[model samples]
Target: MSYMKEFTKGLVKENPTLVSLLGMCPTLAITITVQNALGMGAAATFVLLCSNIAISLLKKIIPSQVRLPAYIVIIAGFVTFVGMILQAFLPDIYDALGIYLPLITVNCIILGRAEMFASKNGVGASALDGLGMGLGFTLAMLAVSSVREIIGNGSWFGIKLAPDFIQPMTIFIMPAGGFFVLGCVIALVNRISDRNAPVRTGCAACPNKDGCAGCGTDSDVKEAK
Candidate 1:
């Protein structure tokens, strides 16, 4: 139950937005403003945390064949709960988030993490994993929306930074903007990862020791018995 493992897992290995690439349906659908993006992120985090813990607790009792359906039911329940609570308490955010709130049920990030990590970990670990992954997803959404909002609206979080920016790029607020932002982030991350990768020779024990350069995974040979 290492803290680093939980924190780093979502940032890279299972980044809800970029690597795992889950939950893009609403990400691209509702991120019209930073506010919407933030609201969606918070809603998602709440659902993810609850669903993960529930599933992990019931993992041993649930049958493998019915797992998918069961997971959805649990997820949909939490999604609905969050929606009702938000609508009653925070009408503004609730309205802005709109249908995207219920859309959380099908968000692959929730399902993916439930299936991959939470169901396998203990309750405490599952909770921490959900927190980390949810926060990571939220951060990524905030970042993407920030760029689009700034460039497209000439403002940050509706603050009106440049009152007269000579007409902002309206396209950045459109559907195309979402795709562009997602792609750019992916490319930037991949490029940085490649550059930071360690130089390697022909070694079997090194992570990249297998010199997977020419024929990928070549040098990734594991120790034999």
Candidate 2:
């Protein structure tokens, strides 16, 4: 695939949060405000970019049997770097993000790409994939946080949107609000994509690209038969 395709797929086609539904923890937690979303998004993106590049560069050297552990160590290093940077310069965001910031080390989106794309692709391609996926994740955060912040707090990015005469729905800013807003956003995305299909737990449409374990293909089924 072209470099542009590598980058563009993450934006909407296989958005980590929206389409793939990878990182729901941060998606629902820190997105109560746009500022928090921006911070988390930027931090996670930086980690993803750095980790993907490192993994791609070391792919040839990493033994196949130990690639997963090696990838985790690489990803953890970047995540720690990002956390320290945030704690030193952006203390407020760092505090607000709290443990969730460190939890990015285990974010499914980052690990999924490391395994499915970066490990197999060239450095340039892996970097683009990381950038694309990061942006897609950020966009999803912004979308959910913006809606919640506005309706829940009557504010956008901490600026009051509704006049003092109108009261905001407190529930929108709470955990319940996150779920409601996320569901709406997902539905909207599905509608725009012309797919109103029912949700399924199966990995039939997973974007793992290379292949996902336990999601046997026709060949595997035939072999068993």
Candidate 3:
């Protein structure tokens, strides 16, 4: 793919959270508030970008036998760097993210890109891929958090929208509300992307084609082998 295509695909077509359904832990756990969602998104994006670049630059030297381990080490290094930066400069966000921040080291979005794209592509293309996926993940977080925050707390980014007299629906910020909002968003994206998209069955016959575990087609298994 061209650099532009590589960069733009993740914005919607291959969005890590919305489309691919990767990185659900942070997506559901930290989206209780807009600020937390934004903080987590930014931290993940930084790690994704840095790790993609590092992995792409070192792909040739890293042995295929140990590439996965190497990718984890590199990704963990960047995640730690971002964590420290957040801790030093944005202490509140750092605390809000808490364990999820370091958990970015294993976030499928970062490791998936490293293994699938960065290991095979040039630095420039890999960087763009990371940028696109990162932004796409961030946008998804914003969308879910916006709905949850608005309905749950009558606010946006901590700024109240409704007057003092108006009552907020507290359920929207709870765990159940997260599932409801996420399902709605996923359905909406699928409907818009392909109104006639076929209903998929099991992984052996899945249609997503993005190579996610337990959701990929049989062809992916063959290719991996």
What does the lDDT read for residue 219 in candidate 2?
A: 64
Q: Which regions in candidate 1 have their CA more than 4 angstroms from the true location?
A: 195-225
Better of 1 and 2 by lDDT: 2
Q: Which candidate gets the maximum TM-score versus the true structure?
A: 2
Deviation from native of the Cα of residue 179 in model 2, angstroms = 1.0
lDDT of 2 by residue, 1-225 (tens): 899999999999888899888999999999999999998899899999999999999999999899999999999999999889988998998998899899999998999999988998999999999999999999999999999999998999989889998999999989999999999999999889887563643345556536476467746644775
- Stretches off by above 4 angstroms in model 3 are 199-225
TM-score list, all predictions: 0.83, 0.91, 0.89
> What TM value does model 2 have?
0.91
- Scored by CA lDDT, what does every candidate get? 0.79, 0.90, 0.87
lDDT of 3 by residue, 1-225 (tens): 688999999898778898778899889988999999988888888889989999999999999899999999999999888888888998988899899998998898899899878988999998999999999999999999999999999999999799989889999999999999998998888888874543544453332344455455566656776
True-structure Cα RMSD, model 2: 2.9
The alpha-carbon deviation from the true structure for residue 108 of candidate 2, after best TM-score superposition, in angstroms, is 0.6
For candidate 1, give the lDDT of residue 211.
19
